[model samples]
Target: MSPTLRSIVCGVLGLTLSAAGSTAAAAATTIAGEAAPACVQYTAGWRYTFVSNGCDTVQQVTVEYRDGTAVPCRTAAPGETVTFPGYGTSGNEVLGVVLCGTTPA
Candidate 1:
């Protein structure tokens, strides 16, 4: 990621963390509910990140990057795994995966 984008992302994350004060517990509960269809990064290297969907339902997710870019949303069946390429540049990293939606299996 470029230094500027990295700084912006860090700043945003910091602000989000600091702004959650008393709502942290509520936010955690909401997040947990929303994360039912979660996809996690199982392995990562310079070139790729492997994401796995361990939920009981089909999940749609997108791979976000540190450079403020993202891969197109993809659907993964329960217990399925997917691979996403990195930004392919020095200092750029995969931020994480975000759930887009879910469907019954």
Candidate 2:
């Protein structure tokens, strides 16, 4: 093949491969079937709230408050628990615990 034609072909092939690899990675992140229920637990106290990870794997969690604010994501190992202070007057109150992605802060 001519030099120019060969270079163009190689470039096209490289782009195709890169696109396919990225598509596969994106698909892998999507849940294929019913997602497993979150295994996180929480307890609200007067001054703080306790969040626990009951799953067998490490999990990232955020404490959601009744005021629609949430704490920064925290990582917890299996059977580990973490604490976050209550928010405003009337002790804001913990509304729920939510699973978070492993993205770095």
Steric clash pairs (candidate 1): 1-91, 1-92
Candidate 2 on 36-96: residue-level lDDT in tens? 2468788788677788888999876766677765355667899998887765567577767
The global C-alpha lDDT for each of the candidates, from Candidate 1 onward, is: 0.64, 0.69
Q: Which candidate is the best by TM-score?
A: 2
**lDDT tens per residue, model 1, 1-105:** 999999999999998987675355433322111232333545667787777888777776666677865354566788898887855757887666777642332
Please tell me which predicted candidate would have the highest lDDT against the true structure: 2
The parts of candidate 1 lying over 4 Å away from their true place are: 1-39, 101-105
- Candidate 2 at 9: error in angstroms? 62
List candidate 2 segments past 4 Å from native: 1-38, 102-105
lDDT, candidate 1, at 86: 56
